[model samples]
Target: MSEKTSTTRRTMLQGIGASLAVGGFSGLTTAAEAEWTTAKTGTDSSLYDVEYTNAGAYAVGAGGVVLERGPTQWTKIVDGGPTGNGNSLYGSDVTDDGDALWFVGSSGAIGEYAVRTGNLNDHSAPMDNTNNYNDVAVTGETGSANVYVAGDSGKIYYSFENGETGTWNYVTPGSGSAIQAIDFHGPRSGHAVDGNGKVFATDDGTTWNPVGLQDANVNFYGVDSDGDGEATVVGGGGMVFHLAESQWTADSTGDKSLLDVEVEDGDGYVVGGGGTVYSVDTTAAKFDELAGSWTAEATPVGQNLKAVVRGPNGAPDVTVGAGGTVLEK
Candidate 1:
């Protein structure tokens, strides 16, 4: 999934009213209200990936469970598919039109659901169940499209057309690594991060080249590009890297294990283990702890949050592991 930055802007306008002095009086009313309000859907089950579709918000998690949020609450759409026991749904992304949603999880499970038609198709059969697929990215174009799925053992699979059977191909960019996240800023520019603290990028999605980092101890879990070939990657040990001037530079945030990083409204937020969340000022190359910071908002569920996304209603929604946990801010 692309690390999207919340770009919401707030402004205030003031107005003055005139009053009649002698006989009649006139009054003006002024009120201030927030433009957006965020609220948690309130579910106990572990949610791995949360995405907004034309139908509504959908969250996928362990046990092949997929939850959809309606006008009022969340409902279980699908539960316990053929792959019964899986750790978690690792990746999810919506189609360009928001009419389709794709999800990949442990045990090489890959599936897509039609938001408008209630159609669900499992594409895992062609994968041969060799490795668990941990991430998926869909191109912006529709019909006869391209989709990339990354997984354990440095496996990267591609589908030139919609998953209508027999359109899958494997493209190995690296060896002996687990790809945890992937993102395509455009149809041609894309990036992937692996468990071995390495990043591979490609202009056409078919060919990839390694983009070395400064810290070998940092295993990047997520990456996002700005569609102009410039991108940012974030991962373990509070490490951040920016692709600029045809090079990657490390942007450290004072040694925090940042699990997920997202950009919204031109600002970046990195969330990680120990309830650590840092807000980065990209222009200044500096970050500060959020109001509550780590350890303050750490929930009773002491799990290492693995991934996070901007919530459906514009809040920061995070997913953690150690027992499949989900939190919203």
Candidate 2:
């Protein structure tokens, strides 16, 4: 997602009203088990997004910085940019098998990191549009990879060869709004959300169709699919929408503009401005706005969080955002 929110830090801190506390995990010993730990990511660049790969957790941020979390610490693996002033990497994704890592950013910068050989390369956007590449989603297994990179002006690029050779094909046509994020749960199924509160879905990733909401003016910042025909979308004004049964239902998330959301197993996590982080237990076949399923977790800092991803190997969830903050829980 892009830096669409211009509210300052002080204003955001003052807007953090009462947070809701949901029940703990079943059979958990204590409430302390639901806390987050601050992980030192070294650089102070604001990390826009994160993804898990075989090498570890990789975070992309300002100045084209990419931090890799090792067993003990986070290393600044990639710093500076193809340009001298450094580019802003807005979104990233890794293959399920952890064979490839892809990061998309400003000026159509696409960085591909190979896990096994430790080789990193740069790929240009389709037709070298130079528009800001905001989000990316990778589908298929390791050997056969299809990467979808979305950006401003409703531009979406697809690469069938892991985007290693700087080749791309435009997929989403005539979309003028900025696509903030994209996700794929099945090989031929995926979703993309744009800045104009529009949702696009593709069964083959080559053709796209618009999905309607009750309201068409809410700007969605992030979206994720659980790979079971269930998907969640979050956006400005703390909007939470669940897509199930071929319908969209508006869910409650208070008044915080949720920046990103991720669903794994039967649970989900959302993060947003003013240090808002929520844990959602999605048990209802259909999402309920008033259901007692949302819990507000404590944040170490009051900075705005941009994106979040589930941790690997039972590790804590990783969140990144303003002031170069990184948290694990």
Candidate 3:
């Protein structure tokens, strides 16, 4: 097998039959929703990605497992057996209609699960088993819904029909690096970041071109848009790039590798290795590290966090590697 295939298989097998549990934290249950907490069916495996929906919050991780969080608590929806096989669900995005959720993982596994009907469907049977789907982005364009997925070996797949049933054609953006995350803020504007610290943008999601940054040593792991053609990309070595005036600007925090970033309430949060979290002041061009600032909030766990998302109330919800850790702050 090739290097890509070998890496993909190793990620999947390492997460198989792993136990997943939520512990080592407190204040999870509010007084009003205590009855809905179901802790018996938790998985001890690592959860790679998570997204929020009208139905609730869904998190996917190793071993093909899916967990759902309702108004009060979390419940396991799918188990690791023949279906999941411990494939690392690295990226996920919910549709605008709040009806469907799409996840991509190792071996090009593209699984779609319906939120209302509880239907789980897999769409990876066509690929040659060499592709590993890593990230997904949804576009709410008029008259046509588009979903783009990026993966290993410099592969990018797109679906115009919302990934229901259609040909997922591949597009090579000339990066020659694995696309780690994608974000579409509007119908015609979006951006994607790769492992080589490069950013690609497209107005129509069809024709993509590179947006040069002053520094190219930053390995961007996640990106998010503001629905106004502006975006922020975060990655390794405390690198943060923002799009303003049709140009990308670089800002360094002088910290460890940043794994993920998210924007909420006109503010941004960048999370990464060594319990590093930085909050960007949108009005300013730099990140402030003053005491008692939001960025100074230390992650309770120090296990190299992989992803972070802003909760409904703008609180930080984070996930880390190894031991299936989930942190809410």
Candidate 4:
């Protein structure tokens, strides 16, 4: 498939599922009013992703709106750009030290928020500006500089210079499928998923090789790893796969279309269509179907949860999705 077509299909699926969760925005409604507190983001735009930093938290969504959690309340950071519905922010990631923040969006738009420097730089045009940038992954924690961007048509870009030099080198092509999500486990080791249900692994964030999933043909929308070879991927048809050693163990919830998965405290939590979130045990090296048994957890909200992350400190996990909803459990 072509790059534009692949990315459009991926985005359309997410938009359709999430739209069905809520008919329309009704002033920031949560499934369980008491379970999750609404952040009062003001706008009713659909929020795609959120990230927590040591300084605070940030959420990005449609209309290029970005909400920053302040000491007392959530504030919108000025983008100083367009004010239409076409400008949307999809994915975001914060640096290990919490000083640097980055986000990617429609038409390959890239944004960076420098905490100490108090600067918001919009780098919308990339080498391939026509494609939508689906996800962004940064490497550091031990103080290194590398950023990876994944998008339509098996496209992947990397820059050792933190993408500040206006040079994003291309990685070797894959199956030419739209890479929906990408995550890093360590400085170099990482895994990514495409719209064709295929998985790719990289040791240095450039060269990539496909890992087999037997005969699975469902699209994989989200993925996360333990930094080791083991990873949990979720997608359409309630599909979930655990990659252990080199083999893939596939399972499903038989209902909701799983959108995102996160590995936390030896447990894997997945969120997706109809606000469904399932937790599975993954402490072992090799996972069995019985061992990877999953149970549905109570969702704080009913809107299709597009993304989830471990809450700040030891608090509850946070989930964000349709109609400007932000829930902390």
Q: State the displacement of the C-alpha of residue 34, model 1, in Å, after optimal TM-score superposition.
A: 9.2
**Candidate 1 residues 1-329, lDDT tens each?**
12222221110000001111111111211112211122234445556666655564577877777777543445677776325454357778776656678888877788888877888877774556457777888765335446888878687888878755778777777776888788876665678888887778888778888877736676787776554435677876677776654555566665657666555334545666765555543333312222122222334445565665543333224343334454444
Clashing pairs in 4: none
Top of the candidates by lDDT: 2
* TM-score of candidate 3 against the unseen true structure: 0.78
Candidate 4 residue-wise lDDT at 54: 45
Task: Give candidate 3 regions above 4 Å deviation.
Answer: 1-41, 71-73, 125-129, 141-144, 227-229, 281-294, 313-321
Candidate 2, 1-329: lDDT as tens digits = 11111221111212221110122112212224567767776788999998766555678899998887665557787786434348888988876556677888898788777866877766755666788988988865565678888878787888777665656678654458888888876655778887777787887778888776637467899997543345688888887887765667676678889999976544668899899998876555544332346688888888999999765334456889987888877
What residue pairs are clashing in model 3? 19-44, 19-45, 20-43, 20-44, 20-45, 21-43, 21-44, 63-86, 188-203
> How accurate locally is residue 81 in candidate 2, as Cα lDDT from 0 to 100?
48
lDDT of each: 0.60, 0.71, 0.61, 0.67
- TM-scores of the candidates are 0.75, 0.84, 0.78, 0.81
Sort the candidates on lDDT, descending order: 2, 4, 3, 1
Give the per-residue lDDT digits (tens) of candidate 4, residues 165-189: 5667777446688889988765567
lDDT of 3 by residue, 1-329 (tens): 00111112112222321211222123354223312121322556777677755454577777777778643345678765124666667788776655567788877677778777888877663345447777887655212457788877676788777565545566777557888888776554678877676778887767778876636676678887553436777777687776755656667776788777876434546777866767644444322221123344555566666666544432224444435666554
